[model samples]
Target: MAGNSDPLTPRAKIAVTAGKAVAAASRAAGRGSGSVIGGRVALKLDPDLLARLAQNLDVILVSATNGKTTTTRLIAEALGAAGPVVSNALGANMPAGITSALAGGSDAKYAVIEVDEKYLAGVARDTAPKCIALLNLSRDQLDRAAETRMLAENWREGLAGSKAVVIANADDPLVVWAASSSPNVIWVAAGQMWKDDAWSCPSCGGVMQRPGDDWFCGECGFRRPTPSWALSGDHVLDPHGSAWPIHLQLPGRANKANAASSAAVVAVFGVPPQVALERMYQVQAVAGRYDVVQFMQRDLRLLLAKNPAGWLETFSLIDPPPTPVILSVNARGADGTDTSWLWDVDYTRLTGHPIFVVGDRKLDLAVRLEVANQHFQVCENVDQAVQLAPPGRIEVIANYTAFQDLRRRVGN
Candidate 1:
């Protein structure tokens, strides 16, 4: 993939320089990575900064309710086999963070961006991506983010005439409907475990009929498109019918699904499935999601699950049975101020585990666990929770902010 070899314009060069300085200052101040703040500053100085920065790079924008961060990382790893890849590897998916990331690697051959579900349209328009990966659509941060179907509709309109090759999950009707408008789409049967958000058709608002692996709207006849790529157990089946076994350091069927999609996206640039999968296998963690941290005489495997759909998939990632599972929740703005989404998640699956609840909204989680008839202990914090548990490697499943808090506490 050839890119413009010319240097950035004088204004663009100045903006990038200023943004990098701000990021460095923020890092020095210990106020968190200045990716977002730095990008915001750069954008304010030049509104077209993203476009100018992205002009020379073949951008791949990844948007989804979940898995976007990990998927973006995987795509970057796979693309790295070809040449240098610039990415927002910190899970900063907004425009500012994306801009800040792009500004750093002007000579990088590719840009793998994780776009916030709400901001995909704007970012896509600005980046003019060579490929767009629509992973899945589910209910997440409903108080601050657009509803699942509404966001899908936005994606549909935003990507209507885009020349980017859209790599989409065919199992998710919401994703299929959204990607349908794209002129070029590579559908992958990346399994969707959570089907709650897509019970109705986004096209006709009719009840969806999911018959085994296939789904169709009886009223309007909107159906699942045949996938060019699919996952059969732990193996990825490319359009050529060759199966590549997916062996990852990252756990769960969800990750395998993510790998399948990532392979497809990188294939656009002629990276073979086997080559891509080999590169992706080295990624053991993404921004500390599945990081194994030594905390409080216990090895804590940090698991992040934001909403019901994400929680469902995360449950599979945890070690099964009498192994203690620490449940944490938070109502911070980043974690969605409304705790009502807690009710939507089925906490009953943790029945066999010694469950402990912690975080700012632990009481809400306690109530939900009670209603689900799953016994749990209410702890003041993760430290107390871990101390209470007869632990070795404790599975700590937390929402966005809670996960970050625990990750920071553990110095991971």
Candidate 2:
């Protein structure tokens, strides 16, 4: 753990103090969030504060379209066995949030940063990280990040100039193409379950096909590279073909894949395989992603499925044990104003399951559920809906603001 005081120059100290004061005022007014306003103030006062925070630090930056926050938590927890880690694990993933977390932990030698997919290039360029973990690239924040291909292009150019060792997912065609040209790289065969985004090759604009566990473009020679670190079932495989079992308190293969990616980076510093897995197993929940809550005389397993891709992963891991599921959606600014992406999500898998539709977008979700012929009930009151569910550990899948609201309402 880092100490109380941060090492800053007189000018930097003034800026950081002013930022803290702004943050305090914002919180007192109940107008802004943690680290968001403070970091903005700090950066406004000193534009180069991020670079200053990066000085002489062993930085490990994690960026992805889907699993950046959870994966960064896995990385930080795994690294916590050695020493303190500085990271924005609370989902404040922008440059401001990154700067705020870094500024506070100024003395910590190790930092596991969660960089936004679009900001990876700029953050990596400024931080000069020792290793950069590149996860799958897909359509996200469509209003802000228009296209996935453009994001991949920016990262491709960013990785080209970076001095860091790139630890990339070999199975993602977009990731493979973006990181293939890097001078130093470690490819991990973290499975790419979502193939909608990779139907077209990024390099030669050719059609791509997935045959067996590998994918290749017909026109160009672009293909899924041979991974040095691979995940097979519940075990992570080493280069020498050794298998080690991994059991996480967190559910889903997505998390297991995340654990493998974190383990790969920890190995760069010579951490034992079992030791890394042990540290990752300690992560039970991240920002209410997979936390089981006792609320309104019912136990609920909260699954934060924000998008179609995330929903796909959650549906795959969901246990069909006759337990009811609370399906909530909200089209807030953070959850994306355009809820039309709901159509792209294949809700067919959720058919024949007990579901309670809630949230501001309940009508929209209920319509989609009915269209899919899935049995569901709409409840304006979530607590009463939970009471109607069978007495057991039920699953709750909620979107951005809905999930956070449920967390506050249930836990409080």
Candidate 3:
């Protein structure tokens, strides 16, 4: 018998024991048990276990400061149109979360994951995905990631020497520059998906000039090529604007970019444009990203505001029926400990008096609103805010953690 006190074999023994426990839990909980138990077990397991699972998967990893979750889901759904696809559908992006997702799938031709930028290198090293999609980078969670440049450096080092086919957003200067070193790179960008703020060239510190559906540095010759797949003209069509004829279920010009990026990956797998477009029109918005629901006998719309860029895009999409607004902020670690980032967002477009401010950081949010000279009422809780607002329709803008809490409180 093996010695119980063997120091060298402790890790192996621990892993074996954990594996047995997971198997037992699976038997007790049935087929869907893995969804509940796998995450916990995977988080506790040795790094080697996660590596083994990653090595076994035919993975496609997606990373970005924004649009990763929606784009990853869309890719998985499009791939699923052809065959069964596995993914961390619950928006879990860490190593253990992804490993648990793979472990839960009984049969899968593809495993698509929304990977966090900081974890991309380690996951890439272990998983060795068949493809990687790098979407646009923007400022987000400065307390955690510090800066976008740091994450870019980490991604470059992580993807070095990998045989994975890289699909990069050429519109983002950082992404374009990062892919320059990679031999296998496919650039995708929407030419007319114009943003006045995103006009800077990462190279040469010069302004990028968009001269007729193409971007080129005025100072440097670094020019963005025409995208393989592009979205042009008005994305929305019709007099009433009740229904957008195009594919996106999510609102705003940014959603169009996300849809285009998803289409690019699907196209790489030999899916025809028509089929991809049809499938895209069928896709629905994920939870907490422009999700709509019925609550309190009225239509309720929920949009998440995590960063300045995201909030700006959401504000642009807010059509005026003059619906009552419920804005919330939170100081949870996941939502960022500092609420200073709120100052960077453009809340001026939100023209309405007596907006309801909820969540643990309601006072901070109210203070920010005051600084912006916007009208708001600080509520003790989400329920009180919802109850106090008019019942015709409620439009909510909330941070990540507060969004969940408010959703639960509103029962939508």
Candidate 4:
């Protein structure tokens, strides 16, 4: 069990057992991964079940707008050097899903949990994690989540009294403001791809001054902190000026940045930078984000980019011009009910490629593409899009629900 020495209370055991059974039923019924439902049932039985399950484990809470899932996976791999690790590897990052993950990995000594940006505070309070990783915060699920500054304030208030060591991105002003109240913080210069939402200071609402790689509020003197670790091009520089080349199975500079952040977080657990990175190098994909599947006689590389910030990073990772790209979008609850976020993306970058748009929100995306003067064909689904694409490999970038649907349909 999670606590071989401490052992769970009888009530907690009953709740966990019941939750597992229901989750199994959910999966058997093809309702989806029953993490949320199962966890909800368990929490209803015991209001404090999450805390009870996480009581004895060394917890690390990872929360961000874009990279939390990938970072959580990397952290879990790095922590494996110490002992078994539990995490919401499937991207089910709510209270119920987190509870389910903990209950399932009863024997895990460490929990590296990916939390939704909105739910981080409550999860932090319950788990009392030894470390919290605060990645960049940008506009995501705008209708569902509060504005960027409001969320930052919420984060600041929530972390004000915590004793956990916070690993924060020094490049994101919003994240810096949010983690400012934490007693202990390790700043990492993980680059931010999107800067639209953070133009104003969270402290004094003054326009921020960006003088190349650094940002400061001219009105309040708020500024980016000096990072103890920094990601420079393909290398990570430690505080001592020693730079380590980051070699990873994962593609893109974003993953390299994530590895740098992971290395810093695991260092608190007594894992050296080299060792942590070595373990992280073993992770090639997270929840099928970068998986390539042979579907309909053609290779389709799956990439998940839910918001503008994510889209900006994804554009850099896709195959260069004329590779043929499939863009899928969905405005379901998980993907946010607002399709207006599409306007924020710079779709003109796909000018030289054959673009095929599909998903429940295909028309919404098509309209946006037309405005950008980018030519695209609206398709029924992934298979149809794949059938029409030019011969050879094709890349597919999708939002939340669309990606999940395609992942299930393609058996990736």
Instruction: Give Cα-based local distance difference scores for all models.
Output: 0.92, 0.84, 0.70, 0.92
Q: After superposition, how far is residue 268 of candidate 3 from its true place, in Å?
A: 1.5
Clashing residue pairs found in predicted model 3: none
Per-residue alpha-carbon lDDT of candidate 3 for residues 1-412, written as tens digits (9 for 90 to 100) = 1222222245634654565567568768664334435555645766565555555456898998777887888788777666678898877788766766766554666788988888887888877788889986767776776476556666776777778888888776667766666778877764323243356666566888876656788898877854554544434221222223356676778777766666667666766545655677666668656777776666778988787877777777775646778888887898778788787776777876348898888887788888888877888876677778875667788888998887786675
TM-score of 3: 0.83
**TM-score for all models, in order of appearance:** 0.98, 0.95, 0.83, 0.98
* Number of clashing pairs per prediction, in order: 0, 0, 0, 1
What is candidate 4's lDDT per residue for 22-95, written digit by digit as tens? 99999999998999999999999988999988888999999999899999999999989988898899888999
Clashing pairs in 4: 2-106
* Tens digits of lDDT, candidate 2, 1-412: 1344343667777778888888788888987465888999998988888877777578899988889889999888888777777888887888888888887785576889999887888898878899999988876555666488888888898889577889999999889888976899999988988888989999988899889888999897888888999989999997777887888998989998998898898887677668889988888889878888888777888888777788888899887847788888998888887787787789888775778889999999888888988888899867867977876788898888899888888883
Which is the better candidate, 1 or 2, if ranked by TM-score? 1
- Scanning candidate 1 in windows of ten residues, the lowest lDDT window is 1-10
lDDT of 1 by residue, 190-303 (tens): 999999999999999999999898999999999999999998999999999999999899999999999999999999999999999999999999999898988877798989
Scored against the true structure, residue 2 in model 1 reaches a CA lDDT of 38
| Candidate 4 runs further than 4 Å off | 1-4
Off by over 4 Å in 3: 1-37, 43-46, 191-221, 234-245
Candidate 2 matches the true fold with a TM-score of 0.95
Q: Which of candidates 3 and 4 reaches a greater lDDT?
A: 4
